[model samples]
Target: MSAREPLIVQREVKPLDFLAAGETASEFKELLKSLGIPTDICRRASIVTYEAEMNTVIHGGGGVMSLRLEDDAIIIVAEDQGPGIADLEKAMQEGYSTAPDFVREMGFGAGMGLPNIKKYSDKLEIDTRVGEGTTLRAYIFIKGQREE
Candidate 1:
């Protein structure tokens, strides 16, 4: 309850698990709501969670999603051990997805994952390496402190 103590929540993502993906996103939204987070912030967080979850499922081949609540910000971190992105620049572009045929056929990978995450989160950081995997950290400002 104090600024010195932060709350963290995490969930494991499975490769291509559509049902679990939805569940994880919903759980995050509900958790945020129960914590008295503003509805708008909750929505933004959920959108970011869903996009990051999808990327983990469809492209990362499984990973972990975590949410951290601090006194001034909400942080979401997604980590994966799958093959890393070769081109960060191209991956950030909208409509530029590396999803395979089946993933696209599932109506999920339109290459908007990173773009949507950026749109909803106040700040985003991506650390990626080919063949190594990636770690994405997204922050949403709260309590009117948004200079980061």
Candidate 2:
């Protein structure tokens, strides 16, 4: 195995189904804790995961978000269908949101989702195609330790 390979543990959840508003963040935090992840890291991971899950529900009409806990990193993969991002750069910018009026009324369309995920993660990769779908893979590294 390569040094860069992640020893991954994966979990897949249907958008809005497995993660409802009141339980998503807490469930994720618990999962991280069960895996021996630190509290601070769990908080960041939960935030990022929740944002991605909401995006999948609101924009993609529901999809799957996979969480992977590796030896030295945490990886989150969110995949969704149709209405791929038109401008990734613009989407990554804070406060640039295309959320519907309803979502905006719900006070969640500040366009900080992607930017926040990128901010808290060590690496973020987004794959999207117009009229098709999008896939976002993010990695958060464990501090002060290198995994072989």
Candidate 3:
């Protein structure tokens, strides 16, 4: 199938589950392929999804990620109930992480999580409130028009 085909898949997952991260990534890849997403674009989408999932697990304390596949775009919404980000601008900067020491020991606390998500996604929107939670919505276009 090609990206022009009509196919959509959606899934909800709990945060911090051991299987949540890898499972979500694999499902996203399969869904993209099933929907006729090009291989290259699927790879990019998978990467972004994985990063978002990880954030939901490690930072959000727990949350849900929902994905929608459209003929020309992929939309992912990741929500979490952890401490909200204090500074969105600073968080978007590369190499600024707040991961705890344990996560750092796992070799993923370099603070590049949010930056990487922004880098791989075509459009990113984050909504967060202190002591409330956070929600991240990202969009990736399959055959979107480019401005001159």
**Top lDDT hit:** 1
Residue range 1-148, candidate 1, lDDT tens digits? 1123365688999898988877887899999999898888888888899999999998898999988886778988889998989999999999999999988898989999999998889889898888988898888987773431
lDDT of 2 by residue, 54-130 (tens): 77876776776667767778887778885999999999999999888878887777899899988877889888999
**Per-candidate local distance difference test:** 0.86, 0.75, 0.77
Query: How many clashes show up in model 2?
Result: 0
lDDT of 3 by residue, 1-148 (tens): 1223333554565655546687788888888888677877777778888888888888888777777666567877787788999988888888888888888887775888788887778888898998888988778888964331
Clashes of 1: 0
lDDT of 3: 0.77
TM-score of 1: 0.91
Error of 3 at 100 (Å): 0.7
User: What lDDT does candidate 3 reach at residue 142?
Assistant: 81
TM-score for all models, in order of appearance:
0.91, 0.83, 0.85
Between candidates 2 and 3, the one scoring higher on TM-score is 3
Identify the leading candidate in terms of TM-score: 1
Candidate 1 CA-lDDT value: 0.86
RMSD of 1: 3.7
Deviation (Å) of 84 in candidate 3: 1.0
